[model samples]
Target chain A: MNDMHLCVVNITFLGKGPYTFSVGKGECVGLTGKSGIGKTQLFRAITDLIPAEGEILLDGRASASFSPTQWRSKVTMVPADSSWWYDRAGDHFPVKHKTSLLRESCMLLGLEPEVLDWQVSRLSTGERQRLALLRALQNNPTVLLLDEPSSGLDAYHTGLMEKYIGNYLRQNNPAVVWVSHDPEQLKRVASREFRMEQHRLYQIK
Target chain B: MDVIALTGVDLGLAASLLLLLSVLSVMLSLGLERKIIFFGCRMTAQLLLIGLVLRFLFASGSLLLVLLMSTIMLLAAGREVQARQKRKIIGLSGYLISVCAMFVSSFSVTVLALVVIIQVKPWYTPQYAIPLLGMLLGNTMTGIALALDRMTDQLHGRRGEVEQRLLLGQSWQEASSDIRRDCMRTGMMPIINSMAAAGLVSLPGMMTGQILGGTPPVEAVKYQILIMFLIAAGTGFGVVSAIWMSGLHLFDARHRLRLEILKSDKV
Candidate 1:
């Protein structure tokens, strides 16, 4: 693990435990848990979407000092069921001048550059999932909180997503906390692993 | 033109028309017999009560009384506004929001009209103040209620979409901007539709009343035009205020979308 950017300092989520964890720059921290164990709720809390106690820090700065906008930008969360409000996928992303990086991201994910032009309604679940990930990456977030990012993908597409995400990770050096059920994917992607069981935090590896 | 007065017999004849409606409901088996009878009685009682109260207020000619009357009207409107919402804000915020918004819109507009536009003898004369406020407050209340209703429902129903934008580095304002604008527009629809259809479809209530009371055609038209504009202004301001303030309630200091501010929407 490189220099730590994302640190969860005794963050307690609804009697779930004073959760203590950290993800270093360029490291993907994978979390596995049984369904209904409040994984999504924890993401929301970290995003400050729900009210929770305990201090979260980014690069040695306290969560309290940072405005919600600044905090969310630094610690962007990609939800499992990604939301698309616009007619076209391109509208969801920020207006940017750099196309080369975006195009490279598309190519890495096996998507054509014109995929951004397609309407959200026309995109398949796999396509939407990948695009949602790409959209979040475009924001240049410092800490990427991914919730089951590749859950909907088949083996081939999942591989492409993992590959593209891995590429983005290396380039950006962002701290990542990924929630996934697949152990094999965890083994491939995560350097450190933790299992959430019965409201208790256990570090497996 | 001489103003015509309705005698007691004439009033009795109007009351008899309601009996005919009750008979029709019974014959049609529409299950509206109880509702029709109750509505007729309620209308009679409400009209009598408002008429007596206005009469006493106007006779006394007290500014405090006029203000008190306006407050009572605003509070009643606030309760109605609270009742209309499908997704209500918990406890006092709902009442506070609607009442404050309507008070700002209706009271301000009524004062401006009385002092500047109409230039009545006294600014708070009950004769001018009560009727004008009644009309303005009624419209403003509906507008505020509709805006609040639509906004709450939208926020609750489409949580995922809103949270997505926020997660993508948009502020709470940017994330919910579309829904807010759309809700305000929806709130103002009744007033806009009324204005559009006023001339072509049917005579509005104020105009029709003036005409029947033997006001000249042009005179009635003038009064109706002024009233409509007043309503439009009041409703517009009221809708804008409620929806914008409710946005504050929806998002916390952390800029999180707190649908839990609503009483029913736990998810």
Candidate 2:
């Protein structure tokens, strides 16, 4: 819950316009757009995951001021299609967050701690999605970029994730940009909402 | 002892074996007849051209001439490395990286062997330098090409894994460490295997050539060992350098995984 604010000014990517926006600490901004519309690109640009032209300031400091890794450490993204490199699901978690913190995260997501011991290939799509979010959250990021995070989840786990994320935002107070196609999910989770169309962002709520 | 020289007729007589292979290929409808004839002609022409060039190079013994020849060899080797890759990077950077990495590794290893190990007077002597450099460049080229191919293909296949690691606050180097290691191993594996099988499974070509040229068997064996060791070092260094350079080039300043830079063409 540090003094953090993500201000994105004149961000342009993939022929998208000079969109300007900001999310204050403890604020969640919902972004909705047509499937191919550039919601993911915007998140990528904000998180420095791809090349873009813009000034992204966190706590009044420009993104370029910090190293790419440094900036990314502060701003974490949970991609919709999560990728697992290691055989066991547990191997993906950073060693420092392995035992107690990881078990707590699993509990929050309604995941069994034993699931970590299972092979990644055997995990269901829903399990992979939940684990992906947990992997990012455990890092204690200052900014969260959630790209269709609930896509693969059923209603039960989706509700659990929503509650978990709400509590996480309250405790961590990070600036969050949540990209979701579901309007109802946005209404329940986001304080403000924006719609992307024609490569531009419009603040709808 | 003087080595026996083969006459043109003798070479043609030996070439008749290839003609027999081509005839057999045609009879069996194996579709290898054309390739056999084509490569047979190409190999003869290429070796003759090199023989002419080496004759002139040895007589002149100019450092400038030796370097020019070396550069040509290096460029050709670089092109081979690029062409061998299944997924090639877009633009000239890919070709430049291969050339630069090969130049650094092969030239340095060749020079070290000539100046330090062999102690050939006037280390740039074309007879010693060109052959040594040629061997190093040939082996290093294969190593670099294999490594580069593996790296680009792996990165393309595992883009998600790599970006996931990047998203987890890992540096690009940390993200790509696995791919890099895999590439290095790929590049170095061939040389390691050849070294392992050198005297046991087969007499190395260079050693057999030296023996044919009337070198004492023990002397030929010593030179073969030196050449093997030199090739291993050259290939190892070249692969590592190529992988390192590729790692830097593949990622942008913002640490974005620019997979677009790669153009995939199945070859």
Can you list each candidate's DockQ?
0.82, 0.77
Misplaced by over 4 Å in model 2 are A1-4, A95-98, B23-31
lDDT of 2 at A9: 81
Location of the lowest summed lDDT over 10 successive residues in candidate 1 chain B: B258-267
For A1-205, candidate 2 gives per-residue lDDT tens digits of 1344988888898888688888889999999888988888788888888877878899899999998888888988899899999999988987654477778778889899788989999999989999988888767899999999999888898999999999999998998989998899999999999888765677999
Residue by residue across B155-232, what tens digits does model 2's lDDT show?
999999998899888888999999999999999999999988988999988899989889999999999999998999
Cα lDDT for residue B145, model 2?
Answer: 96
For model 2, the local distance difference test gives: 0.90
- lDDT for each residue of candidate 1 in A30-146, tens digit (9 for 90 to 100): 999999888887888888888777888888788889888888887888899888988988888875667677777787887888888888999988788888888888768999989
For model 1, residues B1-267, the per-residue Cα lDDT tens digits are 666767889988998888898899899998898898899889989998988987888899999998888889999999999988888999898789999899889999999999999999888888888989999988998888889998999998899999988887789899999999999999899999999998899798988888988888899999889999999999999999999899998898788898877875333
User: What local lDDT score does residue B108 receive in model 2, on the 0 to 100 scale?
Assistant: 97
TM-score of each: 0.95, 0.95
Show model 1 residue runs off by greater than 4 Å. A1-3, B1-32, B265-267
